[model samples]
Target: MASTSSFDIVSDFDRQEMVNTVDQALREIKSRYDLKDTKSTLELQENAILVNTDSEFALEAIHTILRTKAAKRNLSQKIFDYGKVESASGSRLRQEITLKQGISQDLAKKISKLVRDEFKKVQASIQGDVVRVSSKSKDDLQNVMQRLKQEDFPLALQFTNYR
Candidate 1:
Protein backbone atom coordinates (compact mmCIF):
# COMPACT_ATOMS: atom_id res chain seq x y z
CA MET A 1 0.00 0.00 0.00
CA ALA A 2 1.24 3.50 -0.90
CA SER A 3 0.90 6.56 1.35
CA THR A 4 -0.77 9.66 0.03
CA SER A 5 1.09 12.79 -0.92
CA SER A 6 -0.52 15.95 0.37
CA PHE A 7 -0.17 19.71 0.36
CA ASP A 8 -2.03 22.71 1.69
CA ILE A 9 -3.27 25.70 -0.28
CA VAL A 10 -3.42 28.97 1.62
CA SER A 11 -3.92 32.64 0.88
CA ASP A 12 -1.53 34.53 3.10
CA PHE A 13 0.90 37.44 3.16
CA ASP A 14 4.00 38.43 5.08
CA ARG A 15 3.08 40.92 7.78
CA GLN A 16 6.64 42.17 8.07
CA GLU A 17 6.80 42.79 4.35
CA MET A 18 3.58 44.76 4.52
CA VAL A 19 4.88 46.83 7.39
CA ASN A 20 8.09 47.57 5.53
CA THR A 21 6.14 48.58 2.45
CA VAL A 22 4.01 50.94 4.48
CA ASP A 23 7.11 52.46 6.00
CA GLN A 24 8.62 52.99 2.58
CA ALA A 25 5.44 54.62 1.35
CA LEU A 26 5.38 56.91 4.34
CA ARG A 27 8.95 57.98 3.68
CA GLU A 28 8.17 58.66 0.05
CA ILE A 29 5.08 60.64 0.97
CA LYS A 30 7.11 62.80 3.30
CA SER A 31 9.86 63.44 0.75
CA ARG A 32 7.72 64.00 -2.33
CA TYR A 33 7.29 67.59 -3.35
CA ASP A 34 3.52 67.55 -3.71
CA LEU A 35 2.83 65.49 -0.63
CA LYS A 36 5.44 67.04 1.65
CA ASP A 37 3.34 69.96 2.81
CA THR A 38 0.02 68.13 2.77
CA LYS A 39 -1.36 66.77 5.98
CA SER A 40 -1.47 63.25 4.64
CA THR A 41 -1.06 60.25 6.91
CA LEU A 42 -0.37 56.56 6.33
CA GLU A 43 -0.68 53.96 9.06
CA LEU A 44 -0.66 50.18 9.24
CA GLN A 45 -2.93 48.51 11.73
CA GLU A 46 -3.18 44.86 12.71
CA ASN A 47 -5.55 43.97 9.89
CA ALA A 48 -5.90 47.13 7.86
CA ILE A 49 -4.01 50.07 6.47
CA LEU A 50 -5.38 53.57 6.94
CA VAL A 51 -4.70 56.45 4.59
CA ASN A 52 -5.73 60.05 5.06
CA THR A 53 -5.23 62.74 2.48
CA ASP A 54 -6.75 66.01 1.38
CA SER A 55 -7.98 65.25 -2.17
CA GLU A 56 -8.91 62.44 -4.47
CA PHE A 57 -5.70 62.88 -6.42
CA ALA A 58 -3.63 62.65 -3.27
CA LEU A 59 -5.50 59.57 -2.21
CA GLU A 60 -4.77 57.93 -5.53
CA ALA A 61 -1.14 58.89 -5.29
CA ILE A 62 -0.91 57.34 -1.84
CA HIS A 63 -2.52 54.15 -3.08
CA THR A 64 -0.14 54.01 -6.02
CA ILE A 65 2.80 54.41 -3.70
CA LEU A 66 1.58 51.65 -1.45
CA ARG A 67 1.02 49.32 -4.39
CA THR A 68 4.42 50.05 -5.83
CA LYS A 69 6.10 49.42 -2.52
CA ALA A 70 4.23 46.20 -2.01
CA ALA A 71 5.21 45.02 -5.47
CA LYS A 72 8.81 45.82 -4.74
CA ARG A 73 8.60 43.51 -1.75
CA ASN A 74 7.13 40.76 -3.94
CA LEU A 75 3.74 41.04 -2.26
CA SER A 76 0.63 40.41 -4.33
CA GLN A 77 -1.68 43.36 -4.97
CA LYS A 78 -4.68 41.05 -4.56
CA ILE A 79 -3.89 40.75 -0.87
CA PHE A 80 -5.28 44.22 -0.36
CA ASP A 81 -9.02 44.66 -0.38
CA TYR A 82 -9.38 48.39 -0.70
CA GLY A 83 -12.41 50.05 0.81
CA LYS A 84 -14.26 53.02 -0.58
CA VAL A 85 -12.75 56.39 0.12
CA GLU A 86 -14.84 58.51 2.42
CA SER A 87 -14.78 62.18 3.26
CA ALA A 88 -13.54 63.01 6.73
CA SER A 89 -13.71 66.24 8.66
CA GLY A 90 -12.25 69.40 7.10
CA SER A 91 -12.12 68.23 3.49
CA ARG A 92 -10.00 65.21 4.28
CA LEU A 93 -10.45 61.84 2.59
CA ARG A 94 -9.88 58.52 4.34
CA GLN A 95 -9.54 55.00 3.01
CA GLU A 96 -9.14 51.64 4.70
CA ILE A 97 -7.36 48.76 2.93
CA THR A 98 -7.86 45.40 4.55
CA LEU A 99 -5.12 42.81 4.33
CA LYS A 100 -6.23 39.38 3.18
CA GLN A 101 -4.46 36.63 5.12
CA GLY A 102 -6.63 33.55 4.76
CA ILE A 103 -8.89 31.83 2.33
CA SER A 104 -12.54 32.54 2.80
CA GLN A 105 -15.10 29.76 3.07
CA ASP A 106 -16.58 30.54 -0.34
CA LEU A 107 -13.22 30.55 -2.09
CA ALA A 108 -12.12 27.42 -0.26
CA LYS A 109 -15.24 25.62 -1.43
CA LYS A 110 -14.69 26.82 -4.96
CA ILE A 111 -11.12 25.54 -4.94
CA SER A 112 -12.14 22.20 -3.54
CA LYS A 113 -14.84 21.84 -6.20
CA LEU A 114 -12.44 22.78 -8.95
CA VAL A 115 -9.85 20.27 -7.79
CA ARG A 116 -12.44 17.51 -7.48
CA ASP A 117 -13.94 18.21 -10.89
CA GLU A 118 -10.71 18.51 -12.79
CA PHE A 119 -8.49 16.00 -11.05
CA LYS A 120 -10.19 12.72 -10.33
CA LYS A 121 -7.06 11.18 -8.82
CA VAL A 122 -6.73 13.90 -6.21
CA GLN A 123 -8.77 14.58 -3.11
CA ALA A 124 -9.30 18.13 -1.85
CA SER A 125 -10.82 19.04 1.48
CA ILE A 126 -11.31 22.41 3.12
CA GLN A 127 -9.72 22.76 6.55
CA GLY A 128 -10.75 26.09 7.98
CA ASP A 129 -8.94 28.73 5.88
CA VAL A 130 -6.84 26.14 4.07
CA VAL A 131 -7.54 23.48 1.47
CA ARG A 132 -5.69 20.22 1.80
CA VAL A 133 -5.08 18.14 -1.32
CA SER A 134 -3.91 14.58 -1.34
CA SER A 135 -3.16 12.05 -4.01
CA LYS A 136 -1.72 8.57 -4.29
CA SER A 137 0.69 9.71 -6.99
CA LYS A 138 2.97 12.71 -6.58
CA ASP A 139 2.65 13.45 -10.29
CA ASP A 140 -1.10 13.87 -9.86
CA LEU A 141 -0.52 16.33 -7.05
CA GLN A 142 1.87 18.27 -9.26
CA ASN A 143 -0.70 18.30 -12.02
CA VAL A 144 -3.32 19.63 -9.66
CA MET A 145 -1.00 22.42 -8.61
CA GLN A 146 -0.30 23.28 -12.22
CA ARG A 147 -3.98 23.38 -13.07
CA LEU A 148 -4.70 25.58 -10.08
CA LYS A 149 -1.91 27.93 -11.10
CA GLN A 150 -3.51 28.37 -14.49
CA GLU A 151 -6.77 29.47 -12.95
CA ASP A 152 -6.90 33.04 -11.70
CA PHE A 153 -8.47 33.35 -8.26
CA PRO A 154 -9.49 36.61 -6.60
CA LEU A 155 -6.87 36.15 -3.87
CA ALA A 156 -3.29 35.02 -4.17
CA LEU A 157 -2.72 31.35 -3.37
CA GLN A 158 0.38 29.68 -1.92
CA PHE A 159 1.14 25.97 -1.84
CA THR A 160 2.84 24.53 1.24
CA ASN A 161 3.58 21.37 3.19
CA TYR A 162 4.09 19.20 0.15
CA ARG A 163 5.02 15.72 1.27
Candidate 2:
Protein backbone atom coordinates (compact mmCIF):
# COMPACT_ATOMS: atom_id res chain seq x y z
CA MET A 1 0.00 0.00 0.00
CA ALA A 2 1.09 3.58 -0.59
CA SER A 3 2.52 5.24 2.51
CA THR A 4 0.27 8.28 2.05
CA SER A 5 -3.32 8.80 0.93
CA SER A 6 -4.76 11.99 -0.51
CA PHE A 7 -7.86 13.76 -1.79
CA ASP A 8 -8.71 17.05 -3.44
CA ILE A 9 -11.25 19.48 -2.10
CA VAL A 10 -13.21 21.31 -4.79
CA SER A 11 -16.14 23.65 -5.04
CA ASP A 12 -18.10 23.00 -8.19
CA PHE A 13 -21.54 22.29 -9.63
CA ASP A 14 -22.94 20.52 -12.69
CA ARG A 15 -23.53 22.99 -15.53
CA GLN A 16 -26.01 20.67 -17.22
CA GLU A 17 -28.03 20.44 -14.02
CA MET A 18 -28.09 24.21 -13.77
CA VAL A 19 -29.33 24.47 -17.34
CA ASN A 20 -32.01 21.91 -16.67
CA THR A 21 -33.11 23.75 -13.51
CA VAL A 22 -33.48 26.99 -15.43
CA ASP A 23 -35.45 25.35 -18.22
CA GLN A 24 -37.85 23.76 -15.78
CA ALA A 25 -38.36 27.03 -13.95
CA LEU A 26 -39.16 28.81 -17.21
CA ARG A 27 -41.74 26.21 -18.07
CA GLU A 28 -43.39 26.66 -14.69
CA ILE A 29 -43.39 30.40 -15.21
CA LYS A 30 -45.34 29.96 -18.42
CA SER A 31 -47.93 27.75 -16.78
CA ARG A 32 -48.45 29.85 -13.68
CA TYR A 33 -51.16 32.50 -13.82
CA ASP A 34 -49.12 35.24 -12.16
CA LEU A 35 -46.13 34.84 -14.46
CA LYS A 36 -47.77 33.63 -17.65
CA ASP A 37 -48.05 36.27 -20.43
CA THR A 38 -45.55 38.48 -18.63
CA LYS A 39 -43.21 38.03 -21.55
CA SER A 40 -40.57 37.03 -19.01
CA THR A 41 -37.51 35.24 -20.27
CA LEU A 42 -34.86 33.11 -18.55
CA GLU A 43 -31.64 32.26 -20.30
CA LEU A 44 -28.56 30.36 -19.20
CA GLN A 45 -25.65 32.30 -20.61
CA GLU A 46 -21.99 31.37 -20.62
CA ASN A 47 -21.16 32.22 -16.98
CA ALA A 48 -24.48 33.30 -15.57
CA ILE A 49 -28.22 32.93 -15.82
CA LEU A 50 -30.16 35.94 -17.08
CA VAL A 51 -33.70 36.56 -15.91
CA ASN A 52 -35.97 39.04 -17.64
CA THR A 53 -39.36 39.73 -16.22
CA ASP A 54 -41.95 42.49 -16.13
CA SER A 55 -41.84 43.37 -12.45
CA GLU A 56 -39.97 42.68 -9.23
CA PHE A 57 -42.87 40.53 -8.10
CA ALA A 58 -42.55 38.30 -11.10
CA LEU A 59 -38.79 38.09 -10.70
CA GLU A 60 -39.16 37.03 -7.07
CA ALA A 61 -41.48 34.28 -8.15
CA ILE A 62 -38.96 33.13 -10.70
CA HIS A 63 -36.26 33.09 -8.06
CA THR A 64 -38.35 30.87 -5.82
CA ILE A 65 -39.15 28.50 -8.67
CA LEU A 66 -35.53 28.27 -9.77
CA ARG A 67 -34.31 27.60 -6.24
CA THR A 68 -36.93 24.95 -5.72
CA LYS A 69 -36.05 23.20 -8.94
CA ALA A 70 -32.35 23.30 -8.15
CA ALA A 71 -32.95 21.76 -4.73
CA LYS A 72 -35.05 19.01 -6.25
CA ARG A 73 -32.21 18.23 -8.65
CA ASN A 74 -29.69 17.99 -5.74
CA LEU A 75 -27.88 21.16 -6.78
CA SER A 76 -26.42 23.38 -4.10
CA GLN A 77 -28.19 26.66 -3.43
CA LYS A 78 -24.88 28.30 -2.47
CA ILE A 79 -23.72 28.24 -6.10
CA PHE A 80 -25.97 31.15 -7.04
CA ASP A 81 -24.78 34.72 -6.63
CA TYR A 82 -27.69 36.94 -7.49
CA GLY A 83 -26.87 40.34 -8.95
CA LYS A 84 -28.74 43.59 -8.61
CA VAL A 85 -31.97 43.92 -10.50
CA GLU A 86 -31.84 46.48 -13.30
CA SER A 87 -34.38 48.00 -15.61
CA ALA A 88 -34.26 46.86 -19.20
CA SER A 89 -35.92 48.15 -22.36
CA GLY A 90 -39.75 48.37 -22.51
CA SER A 91 -40.00 48.53 -18.70
CA ARG A 92 -38.66 45.01 -18.26
CA LEU A 93 -36.55 44.02 -15.26
CA ARG A 94 -33.36 42.01 -15.60
CA GLN A 95 -31.29 40.04 -13.10
CA GLU A 96 -28.08 38.08 -13.50
CA ILE A 97 -27.16 35.13 -11.28
CA THR A 98 -23.48 34.29 -11.46
CA LEU A 99 -22.49 30.65 -10.96
CA LYS A 100 -19.67 30.02 -8.52
CA GLN A 101 -17.35 27.22 -9.68
CA GLY A 102 -13.94 27.09 -7.99
CA ILE A 103 -12.71 28.03 -4.58
CA SER A 104 -11.31 31.53 -4.34
CA GLN A 105 -7.79 32.15 -3.05
CA ASP A 106 -9.05 33.56 0.23
CA LEU A 107 -11.44 30.67 0.70
CA ALA A 108 -8.77 28.16 -0.26
CA LYS A 109 -6.39 29.53 2.33
CA LYS A 110 -9.10 29.45 4.91
CA ILE A 111 -9.83 25.83 4.17
CA SER A 112 -6.17 24.90 4.34
CA LYS A 113 -5.74 26.67 7.62
CA LEU A 114 -8.81 24.97 8.96
CA VAL A 115 -7.49 21.53 8.18
CA ARG A 116 -4.06 22.24 9.60
CA ASP A 117 -5.48 23.65 12.79
CA GLU A 118 -7.83 20.73 13.26
CA PHE A 119 -5.74 17.80 12.10
CA LYS A 120 -2.03 17.91 12.95
CA LYS A 121 -1.35 14.58 11.27
CA VAL A 122 -2.93 15.76 8.01
CA GLN A 123 -1.33 18.11 5.50
CA ALA A 124 -3.35 20.51 3.39
CA SER A 125 -2.00 22.55 0.46
CA ILE A 126 -3.86 24.87 -1.83
CA GLN A 127 -3.29 24.07 -5.51
CA GLY A 128 -4.80 26.75 -7.70
CA ASP A 129 -8.57 26.32 -7.48
CA VAL A 130 -8.46 23.15 -5.41
CA VAL A 131 -7.00 22.05 -2.07
CA ARG A 132 -5.04 18.85 -1.82
CA VAL A 133 -5.06 17.05 1.53
CA SER A 134 -2.94 14.06 2.36
CA SER A 135 -1.98 12.00 5.37
CA LYS A 136 -0.55 8.61 6.18
CA SER A 137 -3.59 7.48 8.06
CA LYS A 138 -6.87 7.00 6.20
CA ASP A 139 -8.72 7.59 9.44
CA ASP A 140 -7.39 11.15 9.58
CA LEU A 141 -8.76 11.81 6.10
CA GLN A 142 -12.15 10.49 7.10
CA ASN A 143 -12.19 12.73 10.17
CA VAL A 144 -11.28 15.74 8.05
CA MET A 145 -14.15 15.06 5.71
CA GLN A 146 -16.59 14.80 8.59
CA ARG A 147 -15.31 18.05 10.13
CA LEU A 148 -15.64 19.94 6.86
CA LYS A 149 -19.23 18.91 6.38
CA GLN A 150 -20.17 20.46 9.71
CA GLU A 151 -19.01 23.90 8.71
CA ASP A 152 -21.42 26.25 6.92
CA PHE A 153 -19.23 27.67 4.18
CA PRO A 154 -20.48 30.13 1.60
CA LEU A 155 -19.89 27.63 -1.21
CA ALA A 156 -20.58 23.95 -1.79
CA LEU A 157 -17.58 21.66 -1.34
CA GLN A 158 -16.87 18.28 -2.88
CA PHE A 159 -14.13 15.75 -2.15
CA THR A 160 -12.57 13.89 -5.07
CA ASN A 161 -9.65 11.71 -6.07
CA TYR A 162 -9.46 9.93 -2.76
CA ARG A 163 -6.91 7.18 -2.58
Q: What lDDT is obtained when candidate 1 is compared to the true structure?
A: 0.94
lDDT of 1 by residue, 1-163 (tens): 9999999999999889998999999999999999987789998999999999999988889989999999999999999999999999998999999998899999999999999998898999999999999999999999999999999999999999999
Per-residue lDDT value at 66 in model 1 = 94
Q: Which stretches of candidate 1 lie over 4 Å from their true place?
A: none
Tens digits of per-residue lDDT for model 2, 1-163: 6599999999998888888999999899999998898989999998799999999899999999999999999999999999999999999999999988999999999999999999999999999999999999999999999999999999999999999
How many backbone clashes are present in model 2? 0
User: For candidate 2, which ten residues in a row score worst on lDDT?
Assistant: 13-22
Q: Give per-residue lDDT, candidate 2, residue 63.
A: 93
